[model samples]
Each structure stands twice: as structure tokens, then as C-alpha cells.
Target: MTADPVVETLDALELVDHHCHGAVTADLDRPGFESLITEGAAWPGVSPFDSPVGLAVRRHCAPVLDLPRHAPADVYLARRAELGWAEVNRRFLTAAGTGVFCVDTGYAPDRVTTPSELAGAAGAAAYEVVRLESVAEAVAAGGVEADAYAEAFRTAAWEAVRRPGVVGVKSVAAYRTGFDLDPARPRAEEVTDAARRWLARGGRLDDPVLVRHLLWTAVDLGRPLQLHTGFGDSDIRMHRADPTHLTDWLHLTAGTVPVLLLHCWPYQRQAAYLAAVFERVYLDVGLTLHHVGPARAGAVLAEALEITPFRKLLHSSDAYGVAEFHHLGALAFRHGLAGLLRERLDADELALEDALRIARWTGRENALRVYGLPDGSPDDG
Candidate 1:
């Protein structure tokens, strides 16, 4: 008798990492950074296990602002070069088996224009570039420069979406950098105005807008919007990570823009709740797989699957830097998901098809639809 087509199918599918940060380094020393690249390229199961896709967010912009006051711009620029477009793609693609990479326009003035350059450098045949824009940053820099920035960002987004390998924009609204919403220090009007302006600038309908703006702009642009809904750095209060905060926004955007909740940190159950309740609310299991350890990751994925439709769930490595953290984080994510599926299904003697769906469909299919990419096997399609 033929064996059940479970593990084979699971292993056959490609992995679409919905969120990762490339072209950013945590280390200042050149040797240390190079070591990171070496380590990242050597992550296990990265090359042979499955097809790897990456959505590279620009990590240099805001994160740089948080660096120690003494750090010089030259140092920052040098670090960025070490984490340059060529090096990042080479390392990640070589190690992780990455086929498509969506590059973002980072926050820094110098690096803000890096996405397009990277796309050009990668030669569209190899990787996909997606430019990203931050609403809060534009608003904070309000003036002609803001307008110029908006125009530049809009141009990049449109170019990326239209380019051969480039994907659509990945709009980031809320972050620990205080770019999104902060109840204690709300920038609602600023955010709202900035979002409206961004939309008017011909931004794609699928990109996310932070906080209530996701709903506010849904009526005009009926597309998928990503939200940073889970665990983040220590600066962000865990309580604020609740997906419940976006409940009203989800309802408001009902039947309009789809919501892809990013992270969903310690509150995975709550993320599952939203996904279960709203067809438009999808979950991208990015940070949990990397930031959380094995045991916690297992529990969270189990809870999410139990409550939410597997179709609404997605995967992301959330890779940043060339360090061990980035490599291990991506590896742990895939491993954690595989392990969790094994633990859950082994008990019931269930087939691996469900796990495969979670791995492939949940991650890539939903993202493809949201980003408006052609739906086919990553290899053939």
C-alpha cells in the first residue's frame, strides 16, 4: 500500500516569509558583522528543506534613531553597507534558499532610496522588491520635505509593484518607534492625515495602515492591510499588543480591506479570536516563531490553529541582521511550526496535509492573494 501523502507534500511546498528585515546590522564591528553573515548562511534546513521567500523590511531608518547618542553617522552608514543590499540578498538567499525578496525603503535619509537600487542590483529575475512607507515619519516631517518624501515613497511603491520581480508596498503604520498609535500620546490626526495623503498618492490597496487608519482608509482602498499586533521589544507594553485593540477597526473595514495582523505576540489566542471572527482578519505568525522559544511557540501555534482557520494564518521569519539571531530566528520559526504540527497531529493520527497547508497555503497563499501575486507553485509558477 502507498504511504499517506503527508510529509512529502509538507516538504514539497515553498515557504513565503511575509516579514523580514534585511540590510540592517546589530553589530558595529566589521568582523563581527561578517561573522553574522557566515552564520546566517549556514542555518539548518535553510537550503534544502523548502523554497524560501523573504519580505525585507527597511530596518535602518527608525532603529538608527534609537542608537546611542554617541554613535556617528559614518558608523551607521558603514554598518548599513556591511548589511548592504548585495550582501544581504547573497547571504539570505544562499543560506535560506530564498527566491523572492521584498525590499523596503528604510527610514534613514541615505537608505530610504535603497530599495529601488537594490531591486535594480538584484536584476528582477532573482528577487522581488516591495517599497515600504511609514505614515508617522511623513507627518512628523510635515512640510515640503514631507511632500517630497511622500512623492518619492509613492513613486517607489508604484515602481516596485510594476517591476518584474518587485512586489507591492508593505505599509507599516504602528511600531515600537512610536510611529503608530499611542494612547498616552496619541497622534491620531497626524496619522490619519498622513495615511490619507499616502493613499491619494496611488499607493496599492493591499498595504497596511496603522491603528484606526486601517479602517479609516478601507472604504477608499479595498485591499489587505497588515498590523503589528503581537509581541515587540521591551519598550512596548505587552498589554498594547492585544489584537483586541484593532477589533473595532476590523469591523469597520469589514468586507473591504483585509487585515493581516503581524506578530500577535503573547496574545496569540486573541489574534486567533480576530481571525476566527472576521474573515478579513488574517494572522501572520512571524515574531512568535523566532522571538518566543520552542515551548511557547508550540502553545501559541496550537491555540491559533485551534481557533483560527488555517487559511487565514501565515508565516514569516522576521529576519533582521546577519547575526545568529536572524538565522536562528528563521530556523526556529520553521522548526517550531513543524514540531508543533507533529505534536498536534501525532496524537490524533491525522495526516500531514493539514500541516502542509499551514506551512504553504497559510504562509504563501494568503500573502499572494493579499499582495496580488500570481498563485502557482513557487518553483513552476
Candidate 2:
């Protein structure tokens, strides 16, 4: 079949992956690789290799390492090992065809690549997105009095966001307190009490008041704020993760800073509604796409774009640990988005020029505009 001009345009465009994590720098065995491919636990007698994302790695990423399409899982892993970690990373990262990466520097349990390292591997420009909870937790670890906690966190967070190459901030409140909390910014006394009790426990930041404070602080920082919304690891409470719960909060924080809902899945429609209604709201089906793979990616993208304004949608990989996700994500986005736009063109519901423009806006332009990033050259990656 002759590919449409829309497909060809997306195929050649260099994506701006506005949200993602670093890939593991170390070589992995079968067990190690399998664990990173799924959001759930690795069960006895069950293999992630038999799953959708696993199959995608073989289909899309195998050839990047000199293996044929649909190579057996054993064969694919053997080839990846032979190529070594650096070479594997380079191959997949370069194959992903990303022009820029906005990396979340927190959440490194392994020796993963840094933003600069990831950018260098792909020949792309990279910037940082500071994690808000990590900063607040670090402040607690350093020990501050209850009355002083709010100021201390704001100070530390300011320093973190002011660091070079930081383009935005992120909050994992979905995993911590969820979006059901009071939308009003917590008062100073409320913050002090919450911090006092939280410091006594000395653990991860799951306190609802503290979480609310962290979010409000992001607004104060005045950088784009990325929130992990839906379909995450086992830690996520799916019901609370729905982006619709954020409606009241969105209303309270209107026009302050961009609120980017990341990895929205089942709630893509709800997210679309928010994006349509809120001026500062945006969303991306990032981590969701690569996991569902190319076959189902269109359906997911279709739902996400149902009520979403074209300019309000953005592209991301949210690829962590595995470089295959980096490549698989870009591939799925290009294929799925191109297909959707092409269909609209065929139905005369969209003019060819409008389809092409939407393709550019969603794939690269929207992210650059939202994050205030400069447009990257075609030679960037």
C-alpha cells in the first residue's frame, strides 16, 4: 500500500519526548530484562516476554540490533547481550529518532543513564524535569522544624528548579495522596502540623496535606508541572488516578502554570475534557502507548484525541529502564497518529493541510511551545 503524505510526514519528524525516564546502562539477563517490561510483578511460571510490550520489543526493536523481525525472545536477548549495553542503548536511542528529551532525574533505583547521557546517546538535546516529592523528602531528611518545614521545602525546591537545564517540575501525588484532596492550598499552620507528623514517621511523602503543599509549591515555582495521572505501577490506585478528579483542583489553579497530565489511559477521555476546558491544561498518552504496542496504539490515541484539541496534545515515551521502549514508543506514536490523521483526511472531515499541521503540532510543536524549548534541527538526532 502506498503510504499517505501524513504517514510520511510523521515518519520523518523528530519527536520531542516531553516526559521519560533514563534507560538502564547495565547489561541485563533474561529475568532482569523481563521485570522492566511490565508494570506488574513477575510471577512464578509467567514471563513478561509472552506479553504485548515484550512482543513489541521483538517486532520493533530487534532489527535495530541486527536481528530479523519477530525473532524468538531468546535470540533477541542473545543479540542484545552480544552488542553490549552501550551499543544496545545507542542503537535503540538513535533509532527512536527523538530530537529532545525532558528527563525525570528522580526514580533511579538502578544505574540508569542521565539526561545528558541519554541525549548524547541519541544525538538529541536533553533537559531536566525535577521531581517535587523527591525534593520535599530530601528536605525532611535534612531535618527541619515543623514550623519551618514549608519555607524549607520552598527554598530547596527553588534551588532544585533553578538548576541548569531544568525545564519543568513533576509530582507523583497520584501514587502518594491521589487527586481527591482539598483543592485549596493548605494554610501555613496546616503545613507545619502535617510536616511535624510526617517527620516523626520519616518515610516517603504520602501525607495528603504535604502532597497538596508540594503541588501548590509547583505553581509558585512557575514552571510547567507534570503529574503522573493514570496506569502506573502497582502503587497506583486506579480509581483515584482518574484525571477527572482533578477538575476542582484545575479550577483552583487556573492559568498559573501548565498542568500536564502524563500517561493517562482509561481516563484519556476525561483528560481530553480537561484539556478542552482548561487553558493551561495539556496531556500525553506516553507510558500507555509503548505498553499497548503499535497494534492497539491507534485505539488509545483515538480515545485520547476524541475531545482533545490538537494543539493541547503532546507526545512522550515515558520510557524507563529499557531502551526498546524508547524506540517502540516513537514507532507507535508515528504509526498511530499518522493512521488517525489519514483516516480523517480520507473521510474529508479534515483537509490534507490541517491533517499535516495537526501531525506536526502533536508530535513536536506542542511540547516545544509548552515547555518553552527551542525548535530542534532535523540533524539533532
Candidate 3:
């Protein structure tokens, strides 16, 4: 088969991973690595290696560690161990061909690389996307009074977004309260009552009223707002996590700031619908592509772009804990998107120039424009 120019172009284009967490700085044993790859519990009777994402790591990332493609899980792990975490992270992160990383710096159970450290490993530039829930939780943990919670949280969140290198804000409301909550901004009394109850109970910020406040606050911050939608870990109720549930909320916030829907998996079509209709709404199948692997990436990407404007689609890895995801996510995206555009090009559905333009927009340009990041020269990683 002849090589597709679309594939070649995308393979060389450096992606801008719009939403991802930092890679772990510590060396991971098989168990530690396995836990990070799968969303479900790593049951004793089963191994994550049998899953699509695990197999993807071996097939796509093994060679980055100097092992052959489709290397056995144990062999792959051994090779990764031999390389050490720093070297392993460098190899995969560089090999991904990602020029920029907008890393989410919250949710660190293990010691992970900072944005600068992660960017350094990949020879890329990095920016920060503050998590709204983390900011609110910190205000609570800092001992703010119930009556004063609303003002205190607003001030803290504003300060967080104003920090140097902070380009945007994110909310894991899907994981916490889900998107089915009342769309309107919570009233002041309602916020105080919710904060008082939350401060007393004290844990993750899951109160619906408080979550609504976080979402509204993200809009008021005036930077790009990223929302976790569709599939997630075991804690999420998938039905409530759908992006369409935010229709009312999106309507209310139109023209305020860019609303980025991240990791829309089974709901990619639904996300596509919103991106098509809403001027400021954008969507990326970031976590979904890596989980589905390169073999099925084109199919998922196809659904996401079915009605989505080419400019509204962006790339992401949602990679966390392990460095293998950084490489695998880019590989899947390059292969998946290349294949889709190649088919269209062969059918005369689009011009070669147009296909190339879409390739650039989706892989890198779209993210840079959306986040207001400089289009720096591509890193030759």
C-alpha cells in the first residue's frame, strides 16, 4: 500500500496536549504502573495487560524503551525498569512529538513531575490549567466561615487563575456533582448553606450548590474553561457525565469564554453536537483515543468530527502517572486522524490543501488559538 501523505504530515506535526496531568517522577513497579493505566480496580484474577490500553502501551510504547512491538507485558515492564523513570519519561515524552503541554496540576496522589519538569523532559513549553475544585477545597480547608465562603472562594479562585503561566481553569464536576445539577448560578444564601454543610462534613468538594459555584467561577475567570465530561474512573455515573446535560449551562455562558469539553468518550457524538452548535464550545477525545488505542482511534475521531467544525477539535492525552500514555496518545491521534483524512482525500471529499490544513488545526493550531498560547517553533523531539 502506498504511504498516505496525510499520515506523514500528521506524524511530523507536533501536537498540543490541551488537557493532561503530569507523569510520575517515581519508578513504577508492574502493580503501580497497572493501576494507573486502567480506570477500574486492578482485580487479582485479571491483569490490565489484557485491556485495550495496556496492549496499546506494549504495541506503541515498547519500542520507545528499546523493546520490540507487542513485547510481552513482563518483558516490556522489565525494559521500562531498566531504563529508569527519568530516562523512560524522556524517551516517551520526546517521542510523542508534542511541542506544548497544558498540564492539569491537581490530583497528585503520587509525586509527579511539575509542568516545567514535564516540559523539560519532552523539550516542550508548558502552561498550567488550575482545577476549580482544588481551589475551592483549599479555601474550605483553610478554615473559611460558612457565611464568608462565597467571597473567600471567589478571591482564592481569582488569585489562582491570575498566577503566572496559568492559562485556563478546569472542573471535575462530572466526577464530583455531575452535570445534571441546576444550571443557574447558585444564590448567595444557597452557597453559604452548602458551604456550611461542606465545611462541617469536610472532604472532596461534591455538594451540588458548591459545584455550580465552581463552574460559574470558572466562566467568570475569563480564561478557557475545561469541563470533564462523559467517561471517567469508577466514581463517575456515566449517564450524568454526558456533555449534553450542560446545554442549559452552555446557553447561559455563551460568548463569555471558550468552553472546552475534555475526554468525551462514549459521548463523542453528543460532544460533537454541542461543538457544532455552540460558537465557543470545543471538544477533544483525548483520554478516549489512548484507551481505544490506534487500531480504533480513527473510528472515535470520525464520530467526534462528524458534525464538529474542524476548528473546534483539539488534541489531548489526559495522560497521568505513566509516561507511556504521552507517546501512545500522540501515536493514536496521528494514525487515527491521518487515516480519516486520507479516506476523504482519496474520495475527493476534500482537497489535499484542505486536508493538510485540518490536520494542522486539529493537532496543534486549534489548541494554541483556544488557550491564547504562543505558537512557538516546533521542538525536534
* CA lDDT of each prediction against the hidden true structure: 0.49, 0.92, 0.91
On TM-score, who's better, 1 or 3?
A: 3
Task: Arrange candidates, best TM-score first.
Answer: 2, 3, 1
> Which stretches of model 2 miss by more than 4 angstroms?
1-3, 376-381
Estimate, for each residue in 1-381, the C-alpha lDDT of model 1 and write its tens digit. Answer: 774344444344455555555444223354444323331342454421111112111121213323343344355446456565455444434344333334433433222224344333333222343324443334334433433443444443344445665543344444442222432222455645555664456433222333333334333333345566656644455665577876665565567666677777667788888889987777766756644543355666777777788778876655544422334444555555677777768797556666666666764576666566556433211
Residues 44-115, model 2: lDDT tens digits: 988888888888888888889889999999999999899999999999999999999999998998899999
- Mind sharing the TM-score for model 1? 0.62
Q: Give the better candidate number (1 or 2) by lDDT.
A: 2
Tell me the TM-score of each prediction against the true structure: 0.62, 0.97, 0.97
lDDT of 3 by residue, 3-31 (tens): 77788889889899999989998888989
Candidate 1 vs candidate 3: which has greater lDDT? 3
